[model samples]
Target chain A: MKAVGINGYGTIGKRVADAVSAQDDMKIVGVTKRTPNFEAKRAVELGYDIYMSAPDRENLFEEADIPVKGTINDLYDKVDVIVDCTPGGVGAKNMADYEKAGVKGIFQGGEKHDQIGRSFNSFSNFKESVGADFTRVVSCNTTGLCRTLNPIKELAGINKVRAVMVRRGADPGQVNKGPINSIVPNPPTVPSHHGPDVQTVMKGLKITTMAILVPTTLMHQHNLMVELDSSVSVDDVLDVLEKTPRVIPVEASSGLGSTAEIMEFAKDLGRPRGDLFEIAVWKESLNIVDNELFYMQAIHQESDVVPENVDAIRAMLEMETDPQKSIAKTNKNMGIIG
Target chain B: MKAVGINGYGTIGKRVADAVSAQDDMKIVGVTKRTPNFEAKRAVELGYDIYMSAPDRENLFEEADIPVKGTINDLYDKVDVIVDCTPGGVGAKNMADYEKAGVKGIFQGGEKHDQIGRSFNSFSNFKESVGADFTRVVSCNTTGLCRTLNPIKELAGINKVRAVMVRRGADPGQVNKGPINSIVPNPPTVPSHHGPDVQTVMKGLKITTMAILVPTTLMHQHNLMVELDSSVSVDDVLDVLEKTPRVIPVEASSGLGSTAEIMEFAKDLGRPRGDLFEIAVWKESLNIVDNELFYMQAIHQESDVVPENVDAIRAMLEMETDPQKSIAKTNKNMGIIG
Candidate 1:
């Protein structure tokens, strides 16, 4: 089995470890945490080899009655690849260590795209990251847009795409991150950083993105208006999207409507933390009038990129060069389609 | 006071009656219900003169311990005007009766635009129905599109307007309504009736629409993309929207993000039934990209037209010729903008 080590056992790290653990071709070697918090203990309970990021903090894990394997560097020596989920800027600093240790690393979106020469979004540009030592999994929102836009571009050809990204204020677990009573634009400017981030994975797509951070912590909703090169019916658009492995269509008849209902569906499906790892596309919302197609889809911030991370590993190691096969394996192993 | 009678005491009718009660120029003469349901009783409790649509069901109210004031014709004879709130197709049948009674009437979206010679939307084309005795208030989705589009049309002018209407399956109270688990297109056809409905009010606009009904009780979200006559600044678009009384800017800082939070905000504002009678525009989501202006806004289905109903009453009676003044009074009495 290809061994995968994840640094920073927080939201994304823990999820990536779980995803990698589910894969047949790969195994999770270890997960690193800076502090001996509840999540660290939870990681130990999941049977992951726990490594302390700071060697000085080894005693704290022991005091908390959580067993520790070694330091983060020690994990690099053992694993074939490392998925860096360290808080944003910290991943940039850790890149040098990853290079010196001679292990491939996958950085999360929080890190700058320039940190890794090639940015990865599983299906959109999986081939671009082939044989690359380091690849960054674009942010959850960017991944959603790329996954969505790429299909439309291939199937119908894009003329101009405009998307209004309604982002969540915080993750459900983030207690302190919010303006609680107000809608705040992350940056009080025109054309948010999201569109440029999409370019990192999907180049040559003329797209403009505007975002607003809302109070809900469930998922980020993206309202996309894609103008196609030629006219395509709503049926044709829905068929293409439905065939995409990671796009989960939210139906009206299942009695699930809101993001709240979707969360309940995930929990009922026995998913950990009720995380919806796929882009929940409102099936009914898919409509094309004239040459333009419009749909609204929700992206689960923490877990959407988890499956991408698994595929990114496959891409980096050349274990599965074909995106379709790799994504199929990841989606199947994670019980994505029930 | 001008006597205004509501011909159906359902979702839109009850709310319309409440709005009329709040206005100084008009009074709710009575409301009609086919059966003595709980809502009919609530209409009585709200002090509306309860008119029985089917005289045979008048005793049903007595059996339900509810009081009935008179038959439908009795209400027509007593009131100066009628607002038909019955379901679609039912209003078309009632139109002939309204004309025979020589009582001016207002019809809800369920009726065909041709059923009433003049189609009405409060601010958009209040003047168009200056002396027309009968007017039909457009559907909830059309109202939302008009509220957002009219301002843009006035400020920048539109080369083309495209919208995708993501409609709710049913009101929270409509338990039997919806596909429940399937995202079904309303007509299973391109260009839903909503686009033509908008034309009934604002004529000669190049527009197209598609719609899907999802399982949600709260509101309908309209994803709009407008190509303007000339490129305008993002601030300029926002300035125009902010100045419109019926268009509410949902701030990101107020911690109000989703329709759920906006509904809660309405509840906290002590609105009756927590109804937000204005369009909740995501201010932060508004952006102008290379002559294309994009934004996402939600219309609370139940009460949005209530304010329009109040405005329509003034327009029908020539009570307030200025839409700005009529809309202002409607907003003030309803506590729309504090």
Candidate 2:
């Protein structure tokens, strides 16, 4: 089994660590935490070796009733690949340390594409990460877009895509982040970087994206308008999306509507932390009018990238050569349904 | 002053009556109810003269301690106009009674547009209803589109418009309706009739709409994609939307993002029934990409058309000549913020 070490145990990091543990060909070496907090203790409880971020902070874990296996340096030495889930820009700082250890490095959404040679999304660019030293998993928004876009590209050539990314300000546990009472044009500029970031995986894609940050910590909703090179029916678009592994067509008949109900359903389904790892598209909203297809879908902020990280591990380590095999294994092991 | 009576005192009827009561140019003659339910008693408490739909059921109201001032015919005899707020297709049946009484009839969205010569949304076809004998108000979803599209059509020139109406399965008080389990492809067909309903007012406007009913009761979220005649900047689109009378630019800095938060804000603003009479557009999500303008907005399914109903009363009676003056008066009286 390929050993995987997680360099952070925050929101994405902890999720990544869990997903890594779920993989068939991968095993978790350890998880690094800066603070000896609840998550650190919980990691220990879950039987994960807690690697303190700093070697000197080992006593902090001891006092906090948390046990540690070693420092992050020890984690790097023990692993074939290390996934960096530190905050934005911090991943870039950690890149050199990863390179020094000679283990492949994987970064989360917060880091810029230039910090890594390639951006990895299982839907489109999983193969591109093969033999690469570093890969950045696209943001939750980008992953959702790519998952839906890949099918459209294969079924029908897309002329252009204009999407509005209605973002949630923070994950549920992120109390520090908020514009809580208001919505803002984040970046306060036209065409937020999401479209270009999507271009990192999809070369030559004509897409312009706008983002609005909302107060909810549940999920981000995307409003997409895609123009096909040729006329297509709404059914044609639905067929493509339905075929995509990560696209779950949400229907009112399922007694679920709104992100709130979706979360409730996840809990009912016994999802870890009630996370939905698939792209939830409003099935009835799909339409082709005057040669244009319109639809809306919700992206669960924290968990969507988790499955992609699993697939990325296989790609970085060359464990599973087939994309579908890796994705299916990752999804099945994580109990992810689309 | 135009004398107006509401037929059927449920969701749309009661709201229409309250809006008429708020209008300086109109007065409520009475409102009819078939059942002596809580809404009927509440209408009495709100100082509306309650009339029984079936005069024979007058005893039901009397037994329920709800006093009635008159019968449906008595309301018809006194009012110059009657607004039909009954269930779908019931408005068509009531059309003849309105004609027999020599009173103009206003139908809500539930009615088929062909029941009346024109479908009215104050923003789009308010003027067309002037001097017309019968007018049908567009659906709440259509009202939202018209509110946003009118500004775009005049300011940027819309080449085509495509939208997905993510609907609420029922109103907040509507405990009866739901597909609740799944998001079914409603109409199960392409280009649902909402676009045609909008066309009835906009006149040859090239637009198409698909609808998905979700299990939420608060409001309906509309995803809109408009192809502009020319390339406009994001600021340019903002400028036009700002000028629109009933379009509220939703900013995250104000701490509101989801429809639920918008409702909370509305209640905090002291709006009756926590009703927002304007279209709430996520301002930051507005973008002009590749000359295509995209955005997302929400319509409080019950109250969005309330102000429009007030304006439609004026239109049918020729009370206020300019549509803006009527909409402005109604909005100010109802405390609607654009």
Candidate 3:
């Protein structure tokens, strides 16, 4: 079994731990938390091997209810791979530590693209991350765009892509955080930071993005209009989307439920919480008159990055010859049938 | 027989004239145009009783290949009902002339809500305009919103309705209109003029709207987020929309087509474009957690409003008493049978 260590135990981290535990070939050997929170206490009760008391401390495992001694250096020897689910810049700070420890590491979405050796999107750039010791799973917005845009680019070849993303303020579970009413434009500028990140994942694709932050703690909705190099019919577009793996086309009758609804649908469809790409298309919105302009909406964010992180780990480990097959095998091992 | 006169033989006007002529109770008595346009010549060649020249003082018959004699004043006396298909604001300007001629008139979507005594929406507000002598059909945006909102309001009682309408720059056949690549916020402001027009038609319902102008001339898409008074499930919302009289639920297997595809689907389903409400729902967008917020996109303007305008005229004439029965009769008369 491949021993895995999780360096943070927050919402995404806990879910990642659960997902990793569900994998047949992976075992959760250790989990570290900065403070003794409810989830951390629970992780301790479950009997992990090497539990560090703090993320930054070199030697501190004594804070646990049951006293144990271990240094950060000790954790490096315990697990073959470590997943750093720390906030944005923090992952880069610890990258040198992970490299010196000689363990493969997974970075979260908050980390900037340049911070890691490779940016990962399982469906699009899984092969690029092969044999890289450190990889960054892209932010949710980029992940959602890549999943939808990849198929369209493969079939239609986009000339110029324009997008307007309506993002939520917070998670439904986050308290004192959100439930915003106004639709505030993100960056208040035409090309947002999020847009360039999407470009990073889809190199050579000329794309522009705008975003509006709405008051909701669910999934973000991206209104994407693509000017393709060639013209295609709506039927042709739908055929391409249907054939693209990891994209879940929400039928008009199905009624796009909510972020929770999408997540639940993903679970029902056997996709991990963030592995879903729920596209709710308005047929009329697909203006194929000249067949060059194609319009659609893509939903994405944090939860989706988890699956990419898993695929990145498998690719970096070179567990299988074909990266896609390895990713597929990992998905099956994690019980993600979709 | 009611003598139907068509003033302004444009695309919609010509279709209206053709549709009315097909009815046994309606006859094409007179058709008018500003100049001896091709359609005017065609109308004269079709052998109607009189061909009245539009705004121009000269008689069109004298100028035509087939010698005839009539002015605008002559047409006023010859036809019982004059359908004003002139450009915006022009309909209201000519309304008094038609009324003075003792002719009941039908106005297209160009006239503002305040310009007419009564506004008509075939599915939602047709009964309100019944027996009214001069009725203006609500704009395509209002018609689209009413079709989707009215049913939900009737079934679920909305608390607040927030909408973002992405409108097409020009109707099909309009000239020098669109760059087709740019998306500008319509009116470049929130609570656009179109919003109040929609509110005026939806009197007694509380709603707010935003508008964006896109390059496509096909159809307008209204992204609506509605807060219902009570909690509801996605299934419940879908059930209500599917069972609603005029709303046609686009099936999943149909794939995402254009407004034209959806309109064709409505036609195939035997629903007249005017009374037909083609709804592509995002059930997950319906945040029923508190069972309050519901998000959906409604297709409007362009072809969707054409059938509604027809039904509005039928309703104004009091041709049928029961609204549902009238819609059915109108659909049958239009030969929109599946």
i-RMSD of all predictions: 7.1, 6.7, 17.3
Which candidate number has the best DockQ?
2
**Cα lDDT of model 1 by residue, A249-283, tens digit:** 77755655556677778899999878888888877
Residue A204, model 1: lDDT of: 83
What DockQ does candidate 1 score?
A: 0.10
lDDT of 3 by residue, A149-192 (tens): 88888887888665666666566566786322223334433356
C-alpha lDDT score of every prediction, in listed order: 0.82, 0.81, 0.64
Cα lDDT of candidate 2 equals 0.81
lDDT of 2 by residue, A241-331 (tens): 8878988888745665567677788899898888899998877667776566777788888889999998898888888778888888888
Instruction: Give the TM-score of chain B in candidate 2.
Output: 0.97
C-alpha lDDT of residue B309 in model 1: 83
List the lowest-lDDT window of 10 residues for candidate 3 chain A: A178-187
Fnat for each model: 0.02, 0.04, 0.00
By TM-score, highest first, what's the ranking?
2, 1, 3
Evaluated at residue A259, the lDDT of candidate 2 is 70
* DockQ metric for all predictions: 0.10, 0.11, 0.02
lDDT of 3 by residue, B1-338 (tens): 67778777776666677667656666777776766667667766667544555545454445555444566678877776788877778899988887788888888778876787778776667788788888887776777778778878877788766566656667656778852333333443234566577666677676655555544555565556566887677677778877765455543234432344454455566543332334444332343534444344435454455556667666777776577776676556666431
What is residue B334's positional error in candidate 3, in angstroms?
A: 47
lDDT of 2 by residue, B116-158 (tens): 7688988787788897889998988888888899988888799
